[model samples]
Each structure stands twice: as structure tokens, then as C-alpha cells.
Target: MSVLIENMTIKRGMKKIIDNLDLSIMDGEVVALVAPNGTGKTTLLNGIAQLLPSTYKKLEINGFEPQLLNFKRSFFYLESSSNLFEYLNIKEHLLLIKKNWQSEIVLDEVFRLLKIYEYQTLPIRKMSLGMKQHALLATYLISDAPVLLFDEPLNGLDPGSIEITNGIIQNLADKNKSILFSSHDIANIQAICNRVVFLKDGKIERDTKNMDEILELYKQLYGG
Candidate 1:
């Protein structure tokens, strides 16, 4: 399975945020989208997910156009915000995904893995930011979709949770799931991702599997 985007352009009114961008992620590949803030990393993800209004020459997921309902079923996007129902409890949220996505994932295991089991009955509004992030991640884990798009997934996570999250991502890739995530954390990116796609000036500035060189390039690009 693979996601392919060709000749894509994203604009905000008169400003072009992503211009003629082309990229692909194959099965079992974990790609990190790295860029400084406000460089359209989020916009590029949204554009690929077809969540934003944009012009594209071609956009396909597993050989299906995104307009198809099956295409929608093929991928899950973990939004930056938790975006959970404030009144719903953690279990209810998991049940919602199970019902909607027809996922067979065991809620108990997911809750345990994310350390949200104790808060299963607690409403999202009562959870801390880190807890909410766990809930968001749990949803992605249970989705069982072929392509997973995540935006700054490590934000708000503690060091321990970040390690666990990295493990989860690696496991998913080992299962042949194509994952693309955006993050500003260079260390985490080097630790988890097999490929890095660097964005700048509305285009992919660099895409490489050479992690060491990419790290050096990142430091040079951002003056770290």
C-alpha cells in the first residue's frame, strides 16, 4: 500500500502554502515530516488527507482516489488537537471508533498500553492534556487503517510516554502500515522514523533515509 501525491498545491486565500508538492509513502515506511513552525507541515498533511480545499494533479491511496468511501476507510488522521467529545468518557470514545471504523481492536489492551485504563470512565474534559493525548493516540491505534497521518503526536507527552509512543509507531510500521507524522522534535524523529521529509517554502526541501545526514542537515537548516 502506498500514498501518492503529485503536483499538489495548497493556498490560503492569495497565499500559496504548498506549491506543486509531490511525495509518496510506501507500506511499512515511517516518514517524518519535519519543518520549522508555520512552514505548512500541517497544511500539507491536511491536503494529502483531502481535509483541505486544494488543487492537485493526482492524489491516491492504495490506488484509490480519496473521493471514494473506501479511500476514507484506508487512512486515519490523528489531528493535532485531541478533538474528543467533552462529555464522553474514554471508553465511550473507544467504542465510538470501534463502531464507526468497525475495528476489532481490544479496548482493554489499548487502554492499558496508553495507561488510560483507570480513566476509562472519566470524561475527556476532566483529563489532563497528556491524558487527552493518550486518548487521541488510542484512537489511532485502534483504527486499523492502512495509512496513519499524525500531526505533532509527541506534543504534551512526557518522556516515558514518548518512548512508548515511539515503540507503538515502530510496531505499526513493522506490521506494514504506512505512517507519516509531523514533528519539530529532531531527537524523536531520529529515534523513530525510517525516513524524513523536510518541508520549506511550500515544498519538500529534503526527503532521505539517511538519518545521520538528515540530522546534520536539520541543524544546518535551523541553526541548532
Candidate 2:
């Protein structure tokens, strides 16, 4: 497994958001965490990325403990668009990550694929939500991390952009990277994710590789 979490617990003020949850994702697996809003999908990912205050009996990534440098290097996660520098352009941010991760992924290819060249030099302050989203995906591509976490990856994307993004994610899986993401788009999951895990009541209520009945399962479990 590339990520392992056991007996993990997280709380927000007085309420428990994640309660003794256990999750493990194997290499090359694409897992979708689905649930209604406020179900702690973001919290669980943040906890795994070590960005939140969490208590777990065991937590590790690719055999590296959460406190280790290797653990941090093993995953790429930038949840909020605010994490981007306001004054810098998308290319600048990509360059920074490329240098930091020492990634070999070609930036030219990324720019071309995401159609970022149109506004590659535009400052984050001036970019639209859709542009920022493209930049975010570009960063993940250049990070070259073994574990990648995404939240609502298809949100706000145009049809072409969604197609490209899905293709990229699928390519990454073909290369054996572990991907965990949260999304409300069921069709998107059926397109890329090999596994789906439903998060409810601060824990995974269902986990399965089968997607044939995803629609029925979703309505049955989530009352959609």
C-alpha cells in the first residue's frame, strides 16, 4: 500500500469529524471518496497529508512515517486555490514546484495539454477559477509524486478540459501512481476510478471496485 491509516481520529472544536477510521490505498489504485457535503472528505485527506491535527494509531506512506521527509515527498496535495501565490504567474508556480520536486515532467507538454499557454503568464490574482484549476492540475502533474490527492477534480471544468484532465489522471494510474480523490460527479468516477469508497458519518460506509450499480448504490446509500 502507498498510504495507510489506522484508528485515525480528527475533531473540529467539540465535534468528531473522523472517528477511528482506517484506510489503505495500494499503488496504482484510483479511489474515490464520495459523500454529502460536511461528511469530512476534505478533513480525511488533510489528515492524511498531515495538514491537520490528527491522532492515529498508525499512519504512514510508502513505509515512511508521517514525520519523515520521505513521507512528505511521497505525496502531492494543494487543496485550496489560496495556496497559490497571488502575485506569481502559473508558470512561475509550476517552475517552483518543478525545482522543488526535481521533477522531470516536461512543462511544455503540460502547458500544451492543459491549454495553459493562453494565460500561462497571467498572475494568479488575475486568473479565473477555471484557469486556477488548470494550474492546480499542472502542478500535480509536475510534482511527480507517488501519491496524489484531489478534491472535486472535475469541478468548474469545460468539456474539453474535463476530458484532458480525466485522460491525465488515467495516464498517471497507468504509470502506477496512487490516486485518492473526492468528487460529487458519479460519471467522472465511473470514467477513471477503479475503486469507490463512500464516506458517511465520519467513516467509510462502503468500499467496492464494482461500478456497474454505482447509480443505484449511491441513491440507496446517500439518498440522492
Candidate 3:
């Protein structure tokens, strides 16, 4: 149930984004990838999710090779945009995902968790950014997958929605779900994540194992 990356490297043309990266995420851990813009945070996530081809020497996820697990049913990735069905109503969009996944994932459960049930009838095109984020996140919660990859998790969320999102993430970690998420909000990282991994210049510059010390490190690194 853990993700292991050994000497992994990703290159795009002449630039090396993730170079000889080695890390391990234990089961049920809430991990955060932290960095400034263009630090390959998304690229590393893409590599872990197998969305992008990598030039690594070794990559293993849950004891299976990255390529094999990409084709398997155990991993799930939720982009920051949440890519909802723009033309479909919120409820219909959820229903469509449920139908395609054969009801293995539940919409109502997530609706209740996200408290988005009240706006279920609205069309996605008319929904606000926070609502769309909720809808996109709700789908992944319902999937009940082993590993969840999230990029720019709080991109469009307001303060209130952000609080709710934090609660959900904490709840997931409490439930022993393995979660990997990236965010620009260092405060959120301090509140919701157990550890913080900083990405810089295409490499993991720091991986803070102590949550209590993360704030100090963050302030020191980012110069708040």
C-alpha cells in the first residue's frame, strides 16, 4: 500500500525535471508536494500517476511497476481543474461517472461529505469555481481508490470551501487513505499534511518529516 520511487528521473527534451529522485510514501499517509511555480511538482505527480513518460532507472508503486499500475484499477488522479462535464448538470455528471464505473463509486456519499447536495441540480457551466472544485473532488472520494493524486488542490476554492476541503483531507487521512496533494497554501500544508516534500529545480529539495517543524522551514525556505 506504499509508493516507492527509487532513482527516478524525468526529462523533457534537454531539461531534467526529476533527477534521481528517491522517496517512499507509506500507507495511509497524508503527503504534500510543496514548491514555487515550475518546480516540476505536477511533473513528479504525473510521473507517479504514469500520465507522463519518465526516464527513471527504477519506479515502483505498491510493489508494481509504474507502467503496470497505470493500467490497473488501484490508482486515481484528480487534476486541479477537476475537468467536469461542462454541458452536464452536476447530478448528471456524477451519475455519468457512477454509470461508467458501474456504481463502484458513490456520488451521494461524497455529496454529503462535501455538503454540495444543495447545488446538485445546477449545470456545471453555471456553477462557481468552488462548486466545480467540489464536484471534481467528490468523484475521487467516491472512487475509494488506494492512491489519490491531486495537483493544485485549492486552486479556485474560497476561504470557506478551503476549510471544508481541509476537513475532508484530514478525514481521509484519519480513515487511513493514502493521499498525495500539492498546494500553494503553506498554511494548508501545515494544517492538513503530515509531511511536506519541497520540489525545486526539478528535484526534491526537502522532505520535512516533522509537521511541527514545517512552518519554520517553510518560512525559512519561502521567506515569508
Candidate 4:
């Protein structure tokens, strides 16, 4: 039971973004997608989430082929950019997710966990970048999706927030959820990911569960 993509090929205009890529995220696992910029990390994530078009031999979630509504209900995708509504307050955003996704997670607990309870009444437009990031994190935490996809979730966060976010990721995996996130921070990847998949030249350059080996491999691939 995992989120699986096999023999996938993605293209953007004339340029190939992902060529014959195969990837999987099993239950109770956290996998880090590591690569230099323009290596198609986000493109691959979008393709799996079905947010973009791509051709694939097989794409499945928990052993079932992606059925639009079920797939949408089963996973959460956290974009690097904040997507909160300008007019909506923090609590309102949570309420919207609850209403739409039928999330069983409590809003107050999520706010407390993400340390954003005080800003619940403030409009997203008035919040700072860190606050907005917190809001995004809160939404993901409360979504209760089985699979989570995050792109640069630590961007713009302070050190404390980064620590909290890492803990949150671990907690989700402990609950048997699948997590696949892309991050440039090697330390964070080392701390949270059980496996690392390095992408290059529109394909997976390396995949390994050994943290030390992956670090060495990453340095060699990116010329550290």
C-alpha cells in the first residue's frame, strides 16, 4: 500500500521534465526528494497529484488507481507559495477545509500545535510570511490525508518553526501516513527523511535509505 508512479514521462512545452521516472512512497515512511533547482522535483510532485498532465504506465494510491474524487480526498499537497484567501481569517480557512474535506482533526489543537492560535482572527493578507507559512502548515496538519506532498515547506520559516515542522512530519509518519517532501536543506532532510531520492537529468540519479551514504552521494552529484 503506497503512492506509486511507474514509467512516467512529463514534458513542459518542448523540454522533457521527467523521463521514465518511477517512484513510490510506502505507508509509515518519509521520503525526501533532493535535487538542484530546475531538476523537476515540483514537476514530478504535480504530476503525481494529478495537478498537471503527464503520461504514465501506472499511478496508484493505496493499491487503487487514482479516482479523481477519492484521490483528491486521500492526499494533501502543500505548495511553497501561500494560497490562503486574502479576505478569510485563519480560523475561517480551517473551517473551510473541515467543511470540504470532512477532516476529523480539531482546529484548536492544530492551531496550538503549529503555534498560530493567537492569529486565528487575523486576515491572511495582514499576516507576515512566517504567519502565512504557519497557516499553511496548520492546514496540512489538520487535513488528515493519508498521503502528504510538500514542496519547500520550510522556506521562509525561522529555526524554531523549522524544528516544529520537522516534528510534525515525524508525527504524521508515526501515524502510518506517507510523506514525500522536497527540500534544499540537507540537515532537515537528514533529520526527517527515512529515504532519500535524488533527481537529475529528468530521472532518479540515486535512491537510498542510508543517510550517510545518501549525503555522500548528494555531494558527489551536486559537487559539494
TM-score of each: 0.95, 0.96, 0.87, 0.95
When 1 and 3 are scored with TM-score, the better candidate is 1
Residue 185, candidate 3: Cα error in Å is 1.7
lDDT of 4 by residue, 91-115 (tens): 9888888777689999889988988
Name the TM-score of candidate 3. 0.87
Off by over 4 Å in 1: none
Alpha-carbon lDDT, every model: 0.87, 0.89, 0.76, 0.86
Please provide, for model 1 over 13-124, each residue's C-alpha lDDT reduced to its tens digit, 9 standing for 90 to 100: 9999999999988999999998888889999989888889999899998778977878877888857545788899878888888877778889888987888778889888
Best by lDDT: 2
- The number of clashing residue pairs in each candidate reads 0, 0, 0, 0
Would you list the rank order by lDDT, best first?
2, 1, 4, 3
Better of 1 and 2 by TM-score: 2
Candidate 3, pairs of clashing residues: none
Candidate 2, run of 10 with poorest lDDT: 215-224
Task: Give the distance in Å from residue 159's predicted Cα in candidate 2 to where it truly belongs.
Answer: 1.0
Q: Which candidate should be chosen as best, given TM-score against the real structure?
A: 2
Inter-residue clash pairs, candidate 2: none
lDDT of 3 by residue, 48-167 (tens): 877787877666665677557233345567565446777777678667656554446567777888898789888788888888888778776766666778988887889988898888
What is the model-wide C-alpha lDDT for candidate 2?
A: 0.89
